[model samples]
Target: MTVFAAEQQFHDAEASLPSHQARLACRAGLAQTTAGVAPGYIQGNLAILPETYAAAFHRFCQLNPKPCPIIGMSDVGDPMIPSLGTDLDIRTDLPRYRVWRDGELVEEPTDITAHWRDDLVAFVIGCSFSFEEALLADDIPIRHIEQKVRVPMYRTNISCAAAGPFAGPMVVSMRPLKPKDAIRAVQITSRFPSVHGAPVHLGLPQSIGIADIDKPDYGDPVRIEPDEVPVFWACGVTPQAVIAAAKVPFAITHAPGLMLVTDLKNKHLAVL
Candidate 1:
């Protein structure tokens, strides 16, 4: 089969699994971008660090809530975050993980069990995937999902508020939408603040230091139709950028598009 055919097969098999099943798929070595998968479930960006950096990182999220809203966190050394899902295992639940050492990405592992440490703490930051469900429900088109590609994300001129040893330019995810849909998307996503609600900027990608909209810093790029304007949202991936800049001795983050699928329903996070 062709690569596109295989990808479509993968998407069909994973896209509607219940939250726990999705986690099981990930734990079993099924690595794929989590976008549009397990719809209506809340997905999160994962970040793990040693206990020594946990407090500082928590402060970083608190300081920059837009890109780092805390959804669920694990107690030091424990992989399970019971609040997110009784069966969720941080070390193995995500489809893929980025292992960092001294601010350098050293590995992208399907399982972090071998790299797990007794002093590590896990943080689950709210993901835009949750809000995409809201957008779809509103009939707003999501180019990346429709194209079966990972959403395009870019680093911006905007800087996140810093905390001890954690600071970097904010990263944002982009989705192109028609003007009317853009307005409605803003309204729809605004109700889910914990999930990186609403567009931080719309149109003018160059204004955010993105010179070529077709080339993204992370994830796959989708075409922006002539009638559509690119809408940007502060992304949970911002932590990875900060981690790279901070050069923490050790760190782990979810691969850009592969998130931690949670038991919590997307609706549970809506402000309405």
Candidate 2:
């Protein structure tokens, strides 16, 4: 199906239900981007690792707050993160998951119940989708969502603070916005630091070592009109890239746009 069709189907299903209801749809294999689903609820990016590497990864998030803000974390061997939601299940809640072995993507599974291990730990990182609602509320247009595609993401030359083997270049997601809107976006997003708040870089993608704006390391590229400048923000996907670079024995993350929806509302995340 086309992106538009998938988005339309999601919209049609999501328009009537509460956040939990929408999540149930996702859990039942409605597997589509969680962009507009559960509009008011906070959406998080998932990262699961074994206890052996959990401490290092936790420190990694703390050291690099911009790209990896910890929203919720699971107790060892537990799939439920009570802080995120009353009935959250990390193994089956997300629409899609990417399983890694020795840092290489081994599978993109719909559920990870079978992969769950006794020493496994799950981390719920804050996502940009939490802030997009604020941007939309302020009438700041997000072109990727408007175009029914995933946000464009690029890997930069900027290195993250190394935590054990969990070190790699920062990954960013881009949105094309005019100067005025970009300025407004900075103010709006900055209020929610729990989610990656504000633009890390604006314009000159090459300065960040992005060789081709048309080719993104992750996600589909969106059009960047001449009148608009590209705004880059720290993305939760950074951990996944770091996992590959670190070559950890095993890991799992949410598929790019398929996020984990939580009961926490976006408004609750704002600091101002």
Q: Pick the candidate with the highest TM-score.
A: 2
- Writing each residue's lDDT as its tens digit, candidate 1 over 87-150 gives 8899889999999999999999999999999999999999888888888888887898888888
lDDT of 1 at 1: 100
Quote the lDDT for 216 in model 1: 95
How well is each residue in 150-182 modelled by candidate 2, as lDDT tens digits? 889999988899999899899999999999999
- Which TM-score value belongs to model 1? 0.90
TM-score of each: 0.90, 0.91
| Model 2 misplaced stretches (Cα beyond 4 Å) | 1-17
Measured over all alpha carbons after superposition, the RMSD of each candidate to the real structure, in angstroms, is: 6.7, 6.5
Instruction: Please list all clashing residue pairs in model 2, or write none if there are none.
Output: none
For model 2 the local lDDT of residue 228 reads 98
